[model samples]
Each structure stands twice: as structure tokens, then as C-alpha cells.
Target: MSLTPGLRFSRSAQYVLLSNVAVPYPARLPYANLRRRLNSSSRPRAQRPRGSPRTVLRRASTASETKPAHGPPAVSVPFDPKSPGSLSTPRDPIPPESTLNPPATTRPPPLDLPARGPDVSQFSYLFRLGKAYMQFYKAGVKAIFTNRRLLRSVAPPSGTASAGGALPTRAEVLLRARTRHDVSRLPVFGVLLLVCGEFTPLVVIAFPRLTPMTCRIPKQVEALRRSAAARREASFRRLAHLRAARGEKAAGAADGKLVAGHIARSLGLTSGWWDKAGLDSPFASSVADGAVAFLAQDDALIRSGGGVGGIEDAEVMLACEDRGMDVREKEVGELRKRLEKWVRETESSSEEDSKDKVKRLLLNHELLV
Candidate 1:
């Protein structure tokens, strides 16, 4: 085969091109020159100055002059050899002590503002009243569940007779009595609450007796006691007037019936016992007899259980309240003392004297203290 310029044929019959005709290779270089070329090719080329050397030098001098002489004194920070970045990054300036810990400013004395008055708005009052009623309802429910056994075992107020063959303990009697009174009030109060809604407070205020012992507010309870005390004083005065009118015949059967009726009314035995017609009716006489029987039975039951002193503190207070005594502002100790006196006086009296003793005690309820 014919060969082209700068071309040769191998023994295998393959064409081998040593160099291109248009671009020739340079002559072989010396060892030193070859090494320098290799190094120059491997390294990055430096950028040339855009301006004259004098201008560049002038700029460098001006920059040096403008720079602070002592670059924020190199803060001697603890260097970690392992942290390579720490050596390159400039340290942040140290803050002054004043900035680190600012001085505490003196606060002005608090203004002597007048105390705020109680919230009297209808909505506010209603909200609080509802909360109180809810608490009262919850307490009543808990009491009912807790004393359900006792309630089941004892007869209600209307029955005035023990259900169980065994004579009930003082605690059982008190629980049964309180449960009956509270249960009676609960249904009516619940109806009022449902019907009246927010206006239930007004209804409760108008008829405080409708409120259960557990549901009565401190203010309402105090008011009720005060009113009851006044009524009790009036009842005593009426009894005195009746006795004076009867003169020497005050102890006679007719006079005694009249006295018993008055006693029943004073003790709140019946709802309409105060009506003149009801007072002298057969119903009133039966009610008076029942009241006397209930008192005598209760007195015996109390004596069987170690008298008034053996009763629980709560029961003593309840008993006092039941007997038309003013329990407001009175401690349990004071109540026990008064109740103990009444129980002892009744126990020591004869059958005839005991009836009179109960009447006197019931009329002058608070006077026992």
C-alpha cells in the first residue's frame, strides 16, 4: 500500500499515524525543561493585574493605612487543634460587663387602690349561684348514696315510726331524719331550678325553707335562723297569752288540747297547722298526739344511746335545728351543751312533768343555752 506523509504501515497491515501533517510535534526537550513543563501544567495559573503595578501598589498602601492598627486585640480563646475552622474564623468581640448584667431598676411603690366591690351584675350573680347549686346538688347526691342503707331502714318523717325491729342508733336516727327532710326538699328545688332556670336564686330567697340543709348558703341559712328565732319568740308570747286567758283552768283537758295544738304549730308539725279551723279540728288533735309520741319515742331512743352527749357533733347540730333552736353562730360544743341540758331535764321529769318539760324546751328552744 502507498504510505501518506507522516504515516507508516505495521507488520499486521494496520496504518499507524505518528503525527498530523498540519500540526507537527516539537523536538524532544531536556530533562530539566520537561520537569518544569509538567509542573506548570499541573499548577493553577495566577490572575494578572488589570491596572498598572504602581496603581495596584498605591491601592494596597491605602488599604493598609485605612485598616485599624490593632485588629480587635486577638481574643486569646482556648484553641482546639482538632477544630481546624476555629483557627480561620475571626473571634466575636467580647461584650462589656454592663451589657452582660444590666443594673436592676427600682420599681415604684404599688398604688394604694381601694378594694374592689363584689360583682353585683345579674349574670355574674347567676353564674356564681349556678356553680354553688351544682356543688350543693353533688353533695346531696353523695349523701343520699352514702346513707341509702340507713334511709331504707328508717321510716320517713310522716311515718314517725321506726321501720326496723331494733332501736336505731342516734346516728341512724339523725341520718334518717336529715335524709327525709333533704329528699323532700330536693324534688321541689329541682323542679324550681328547671322551671325558673337563672331566676332560681330569687325563688330560693323568697322561700328559704324550700332549700335543703346541704343546699342553703351561709347567708340564707343565717337569715332563716334569724327569722325562725323571731317566730319562735312570737310563739312563746302567744302561748303565754293563751295560758293567761285560761287563768287557773290552763291545766284542764280543753286548755291542754289548746296548748297541745299550739305546741304542734310551734314545732311545725303540719303545713297549715296555724289556720284557726285546722288548729281546733280532729286532724290537729291527732297530729298533736303524734308529735308528742314522736318526741317521747325520740327522747327514749336518745337515752338508750347514752343520751345527747353520745351523739355525733353533726347530729347534735341537726337535732338542735329540728327542735326549732337558732343554730346560727353557735359552735358544736355550745350546741352539745344546750342539747345535753334539755335531754337531762326531760329525763329527770315525771310523765306529766316530762310533757310540760318538752313543751317548755320546744317553746324556749334557744333558752337552753
Candidate 2:
């Protein structure tokens, strides 16, 4: 089927965004401006000596940039512009050859119905009539005696879920239930690529849940939302290990602002973490002169906890790192989980009570040295 139009990303494109953050989305960034941002952020702050941590970082980044490597390996963040996935230059478009297919034996099975008996003539006029009363079979002898028309209806009985209610098939009809599956497996980061190589029937598909035009838009919207939620949950499931890692380092502020930026960018964070974090603080500022990781205020009210009619403040943990991080899907899944837990405990508590909570975060949310 043709795409439903507007905001419907190509399956390959969506997979690329979800599966590989290293390859940024198709956002148009002016190369000159990005270079300036990168260069300016890369520069060292003043008042620090050449051997200071910040100054040392500048030298290392400069050295890496000056003599670029030809091919840095997976998860490499070499400063050089010549590598395949260099941070200095615009990322190359993911090649089409790399976007498609998996060998058989492992592909996700298509969403299909159990075979109907060959004798079940779906097209027979008599069969169509019977299918209409699939729900009434439960009404039993009383309803059978009450309505001759209902009794004669020969549709398959409703499944247990919708028994005694309106025909379950109404949803089946409203949903226009037919079968469709795509991607040999449940859709994930690399699934879209596989679709590019194969041709199919019964519409095996996931993500961006395509619908037959007959389905109502409201139903379509719900389906789309459910599909998106499933994908996001699946994304975190892969990172459950990151959440449980022990003894993470605190703010990493001790290392200097540049280090914070390095960690944030490597983890795919952007400027304005406070607002993104939805925390209240009196004196938070960016990690450095350029501002990738900002500092929280020494004494500020946390709106997250103080408001009435709000959800349990503990749940704020999810909101803290609500957005995705930039690092490879594998690196910081556990870290995200930890931050999520930390925000939750801190938000639910009194400021006086949360002092130890904050200290725990600084001590354990360890940054890469």
C-alpha cells in the first residue's frame, strides 16, 4: 500500500533514526554553523593553565584532529574528519546496500491466521449471513427462543473476550481485521533495512502502523501511538543492564565543563538539560562557556514535587531523561535507568530528606574518566 502521506517516514528512514543515533536524522544542519559550534565548544576556557585538565583535553582533541585516522573502529569518537563516522564532518547517508534483508530461518513469522478449513467457503452468501451473528451464540436457549433471526445466524461464536457484549466481531469489523506483517522480525533499529530487499503479501509490517483507508482516523491514531510506545519500550529493554551498573561517578563536574560536554554529547544530549530535566534550581548553568551540560541551582524549589494534583513525584524519574540519549544504544542504557531512579526518589522527597539522595547521585552516576 502507498504510504498514508505526511509524517509517514520511509520504513528504512525510521529504522535509521531509531537504530542508529550516530547517524543523525535527516535534519538539515548548515555545515559551516555546525563546524563553528563544534570548534568553539572544543576550545579551552581561559584562566586554566596549559596542563590543566581542560587545557589537556584541547590539546588531545587538536592532536586527534590534525592527523586524522583513516578508519576509526565501532563506537570510535576520534576527532579527525576523515573517518567513516567522524564527528567533524557531516555523516554520510547510510548506504542502501546496508539497509536491507536477513537470511531465512530467523525472520519474524508473518502475522497470519490459522488456516481456515478448505471447506469453509468464505465467499458463499450463506457463510456471509452466518458470520454476522458470531456474538449471539452465548445468549443461549432464551435468546434462541426470543428471536428466530438471531437463532438462525450461523457465524462462528465470539471469542471469550467479548462474550455477552456487542459482537466481538464489531471490533473485528471496525478494525477491518485482516492480516499484515512486515520486517522478518518485530521491527527494531535494523528491521527497516531488511524490508528494502524483500517483496511481500499479507502486509507484514510494524512501526508507523499502516492502515487500510477504511479504518477510522481515531482508531488509526491509537494504533500509531501503541506502536510507538512498543518501540520505545523495546529500546529501553536493550539497556536494562546499564540501569543496574554499580558505583557510577558523581556530576563529573570535578573534571571540568569540557568533560561534561564530552560525556553528554557521547551520550547524545543537547543544550538545556535543566529544562529538559524539568528540575527546579537556583544556579544551574551549562558545563562550560558553550553550555552542553548545565549545573543545577544550590537552592531552588523543585516544581516537580511541590505541585498539587500532579502524579507521584517519584515518577518524575522517567521525565528526567524522558528523551533519548545520543550514545550508541549499548553504552548508557543502564545510566539512563539510574538517572531515572535518582530523579524519582529526589522528587518524591522533602529537600532536607533528599540531601543524601543528591549525594548518592554524584557518587554513583559515574562518568567515563
Candidate 3:
């Protein structure tokens, strides 16, 4: 013991000694501890059950919940077959005394005839309606020819007389204008009648512009007026935009040639009657000139005819329509007042005050404000 060597050695020698040594496993562990360790390490994990209590409660709550009602209220009203807006109402309802009886006529029966009630059947009604429409179409065609003849008779021989001749009477002008408008739409009306057949009335009601003025019922006329009012408002907005884009000074010039061009394009004077263009082209200027002349003539005619008061109701409506004014829901008296205002302003203004005149016609002047 007195001569025992210290355990410490040089680093290289200690590393060599440790590298050659072997560690032994413990062989004396207790059986209970070894068994417990093996059982715990080898045991399988327990899985959670499907549809647990919390999940079932959540699903039950959701299923028991009620949703609120949506959309319009459910109060039912009885349908009126006599109403003009009713789908079941006759499109062209004729009384028993009307002369347009299909049975009394010698013409052959329509190719498509409804088999129900002889007098009240769909085919009977449509046949009578067709006859009525044909009557109107025939009248319009006749008037067109008659007006053309009258106009030609009054027209001087080519190159023999000056371009200026006696102006047509107010009646002739009004008749010619109405007939031309109705006749021009005949082809389209015929096509719709052919294609739509029983449904033609519904189509015409929805698109009143497709039918001629002569064939339009009161309801269709009202619908058209409403649509015209919307279009007039749109034109006003477009004019405002144009005025903004061009300087205010240009828009308010004395001659108002630029504004005149825009007004002409809006009034359907451009080629194709739907083209949109500014005063950048010569064609626009020419169209504007034509528009101005037409308006001046109309003004002169109105003045010569004893102002707005002397014109008939139909003539008043036509004038309002031509000038892009809103004629919706207006009575004869109210329309006359509006027209009188325009005429009064125009009377005091010169021909060069075109912008103001057009503005008055369009109802876009300070009067609107």
C-alpha cells in the first residue's frame, strides 16, 4: 500500500488504457422492476371513440335551430282577368258591336285556330285582333300614299321653279309624319306577328317601340312614354359630359355650332341615326345644319299656327317627343304650359341663339333647375 502508484497518468497513456477497456452490463436487477418496465414499454395505445358526447351535443343543437323567413311577404291577392297588365287578358279586346268579326268575313280561316269556345277562344280573339291590326296597317298605308300624292302635287316641277315653294299645312305635315313613321315600322310588325303568333301581343307590350303608333294601346303608350323619359334623362347626362369635356366657353358660344353638332347626333340626325361623334367631321356639321333647319322650320310652323295653344293633343305629344322632352304622365294642360315656356323663350331669341333653343327643347335649361 505504501508503494501504490497514483491513478493519474499522461493524457496519451490514459486514452490508450481507456480504449482497451470493456464495460460490463449489470446482471443483478430485481425481477419486479424488469417486468414493469417491459409491460409499460410494449403496451398499445387506446383509441378515442367516434361520436363522443360533446360532438353529439353539438350536432343536436345545430339540427334543432330554425332559420328566419326570407323574401317578400306571402299575402295572396285575387287575380283580375280584366286588368290590362294581366297575362290572361285579351291583347286586343273588341266589343260585340265591332265590325272586325272573323265569322262574318269571306276570308279563309287562320292556319292556326284554337279549338275552345267559338266566340271566346284564343284563336277567335287573335283573329279579331289580327283583323283590327290589318285595318290600322291598311289605313296607315293609304294615308302614306295620299300624303305623298298631295305633297307631289304641291311640289313644283324640277329646275322650272325655285327650291322654295308653299309650305305644307300643319295637317299635311302632321299626317305625313305620322303615316311615314307607322308605315316604316310595318315590316318589323309583320315579322313579329308571324314569328310570335299568339305571343305577339306580349312581345309588343314588353317592347312597345316594336309596334306602330296606330296599334299601341293605352298601356303600351304609357310604357313608351316612361321609356322616352328615361332616354331623355340619359341624353341630358351625355350633354353635360360633352359640355364638361369641351370648355364651358366653347359650349356657350353665340353660334353654338359645337353644341348643335352634339344635339344633332343625340336627336338621331347622324348617319345610321345611332352613330356617336363629335364636331370633328364635316358630316357631323352637315347633320347639325340639317337639324337646325328642321328645328327652325318647326318653330316657324308653331308660331304661324298660333303658338302651342293652337296645336292638337297628338301634335303636342309629337313635338315633345321630337325635341327629347319627357312626356310621361303629363296632361294636355301641363304639356301646353311646358311648350309655351319653350316657345316664349324661342320667340325672344334670334336664330344664332341655337344652344339656348336646343337646351330649352331638351328641357336642360335653367328652367329645369
Give the TM-score ranking, best first: 1, 3, 2
Q: Taking the candidates one at a time, how many backbone clashes does each contain?
A: 0, 26, 0
Q: Kindly report which residue stretches of model 2 are placed more than 4 angstroms away from their true locations once superposed.
A: 1-254, 270-320, 323-341, 344-363, 366-369
Q: Can you write out model 3's per-residue Cα lDDT over 1-369, one digit (the tens) per residue?
A: 343355444655786566556422342234755876787789976665579899978887997463322111111122221222111112243222111111111111122223446458776777776665554444433434443443333323334442344454344344445555666876897787678764565678876766766556566667766655554455556667766786553355454555665565455454323334323345766766666566665666677655676555655666666665566667878777877776666664566574356554543543321
lDDT of 2 by residue, 293-317 (tens): 1112111122222221122222222
Q: To one decimal, what is the Cα RMSD in angstroms of model 3 from the true structure?
A: 36.1
Candidates' lDDT values, in order? 0.54, 0.30, 0.51
lDDT of 1 by residue, 27-106 (tens): 22236558767988999988977799999898888974542221111212321212211111124542221111111110
Ranking by lDDT: 1, 3, 2
Quote each prediction's TM-score: 0.54, 0.19, 0.50
Q: Number of the top candidate by lDDT?
A: 1
The parts of candidate 3 lying over 4 Å away from their true place are 1-119, 153-168, 175-224, 242-250, 254-258, 265-285, 348-350, 353-356, 359-369
Measured with C-alpha atoms, the lDDT of residue 293 in candidate 2 is 15
Per-candidate Cα RMSD to the true structure, in Å, reads 36.8, 30.4, 36.1
Model 2 residue 139 distance off true place after TM-score fit, in angstroms: 38
TM-score, cand. 1 vs. native: 0.54
